[model samples]
Target: MLIGAVVLVLGSLFLVVPFLLGNTGVTGFVIGFIASLIPLTVVLLTVRLIDRWEPEPKRLLWFAFTWGAAVSIAGTLLIQPLFALAAPTSSEEAFTYFMATVQAPIVEEFTKSLGLLVLILAARKYFDGPVDGVVFAFTIAAGFAFTENILYFGREIASSNDPGTDLVRIFILRGVMSPFAHAVFTGTTGLIMGFAARKWHSGYAVLAFFIGLLPAMFLHNRWNSMGQNFLVEYFVVQVPIFLVAAVGIILLRVAEGKLTRQRLLEYARAGWFTPAEVEMLATSRGRRQAIRWASSRGRGRAMKSFIKGATALAFTRQRILSGRDVHVHQHDELELLRKIPTLRAAVLQ
Candidate 1:
């Protein structure tokens, strides 16, 4: 019951960001939706291409987005109101300083990072490694940014009565310059959370938490600072950085995708995969071919199910080998595994 409540709370938080953005205006709403959705869809499809073996649960993905929206909204609302009162900005410079340097960096990063905390607390096992922490953090941060963009765009359209430069500027800033701004910000939190989840050291965990938060806050500050110089500002500063980050991100995913291959290799050395099954998940090329083999032979669904079941087998095997009983429903697990051969036979038919 408590777990269910937590999930519900997290989902509602994420749902609100898009809602807020849409309410901004038709033009801003449309532009913001297009800007964020296209990039995110590509990312998702790319993730599918790579991690074909064990897909993260769809429910968790939804929860991440929802968690970001809700937590961000609540955090900004709670914090910013106080900040505004504290700053007492009567001039543009003061207001700008208060907002860009102070309010935006702190509020956005913290709220966006809350999802990492939730992920750490709830499902530590699913986090494959450090890179996953970064990816998940980026996801929540982007979700928050997407919603924030909606609101900002809606206002731009409402005031100007057109989808103008302000909207484009936002695209450049949120979509371009700081593509990984929020990711970097919340990524720190994720690193800490990931480490903490794996280890049970409260003192070290607290230290990790602060260490992570510092870099995130600093990055947000620098990104916002870059915007202060209006004319000189361009993707020149960001493009190279983003490219480097992109390479790192790709390598991380590629490494993660090789988990099955690693597992297969471990036992392939001992003859678990019959050389054929081992070859299937060994490389990106091999994984694709395996999927295609399954799909072309008109066994797409069964292939997907088989691959998924096989992954479950792997993870269960891990737990069993570790002598863990947390998930020791062996009868149920075997029953599920037994269905795979039946499904495969149907595919063969």
Candidate 2:
């Protein structure tokens, strides 16, 4: 079922691309789609590395990404045309301004943010932490961006009767610099969604999520408005805003990385993992490095089994840390998972 959903959503997004645009050369359209897709691929790899606790199925990941693209593309297509109706009689400036200032932000934010609600309501187990929330939201946003690039790129190609310039701009703006734009916009909702999931309160989730989304939309729209005036916007606004957003995202990831280590440390001290094992889980990079080091020595599968076992051990330790005795509440499943690390240690000798 999950696989079906992923395929269905992805297929639908592919169909939507050509329908939305009036004109586009096949080469430029393909370039635009591929250009937008590369970032989406890189970020998913990052998500997989970070989310060891309950890594979502690859199928579900695709479903989320595809859903974002399909829905957001449809939304902008349906609404933006209306704004074109409201286009100013005097100049193209009015049409561009209206789309930038009024239509795009509201539609795009809502469309991308639908993923938070979907994940929270439908797939409860996958909702682990802020990173998961961000990953989900970003995938959805990427999906939207992918379809959007196709439409806008396709139109530009058709209008100019030459796809060359359109391809270059798409590569720079949508492909390179702006992948973060949709992700950041929907992230405010993710922050709220994560809090709500942790609390297990539905009404609270909706309230908090939208509260975050509304502000995000405003910021997104503001950035778009300023940014359309490139010369003035770059020096006066865009660069500074980019720097701030970039720094903020870095801080959040750093804090998340720190907490992950701290949690493992606490678990290790409680005997959920050995002091040596906890050291490995402290950073995913370290864990991978250690695993590669082990595999080179011919213990590859055993090492992965060891990490999986360690994870179960870590979960048991977490339960213990949460409970009265720090030991009594842990059950049989945890015991079962702990054996892999034990086996790995035995092999190490």
TM-score of model 2 (CA atoms): 0.78
Misplaced by over 4 Å in model 2 are 1-15, 25-28, 45-54, 79-92, 227-232, 239-250, 257-272, 284-289, 300-305, 308-339, 342-349
What is the Å distance of residue 132 in model 2 from its true position? 1.4
Q: Where does candidate 1 stray beyond 4 Å?
A: 1-36, 39-52, 86-90, 176-180, 200-207, 228-236, 266-272, 315-349
Taking the tens digit of each residue's C-alpha lDDT, what string does model 1 give over 1-349?
2477476666665656455654765665666666677545544454454344566566666667666656566667667877787774689788878788888888777776766666655665565345556657766766676666566656666666445877787667566555555665676676556555444344544465566777788767777776556446545654565576668667766765566566656655764455677566455676577779888987778766766665655554544454434455355357655775675566567
Query: Could you estimate the TM-score for every candidate?
Result: 0.78, 0.78
Question: Which residue pairs show collisions in model 1?
Answer: 13-69, 13-70, 14-66, 14-70, 21-150, 21-151, 24-154, 25-154
Local distance difference test values of all predictions, in order: 0.62, 0.65
Candidate 2 weakest ten by summed lDDT: 318-327
For candidate 2, write residues 1-349 as lDDT tens digits. Answer: 4665566566665657557544456755765566656766655565555455435567667767777778556556666777678767577777788778777888778767766776776675555456567667767776776677666666666676556776677667765766666766776677667656654556766776688688678878877876537667755765686678557656656665565567667766766667766767555676788789888988876777666555545444443554423444356345654575576675485
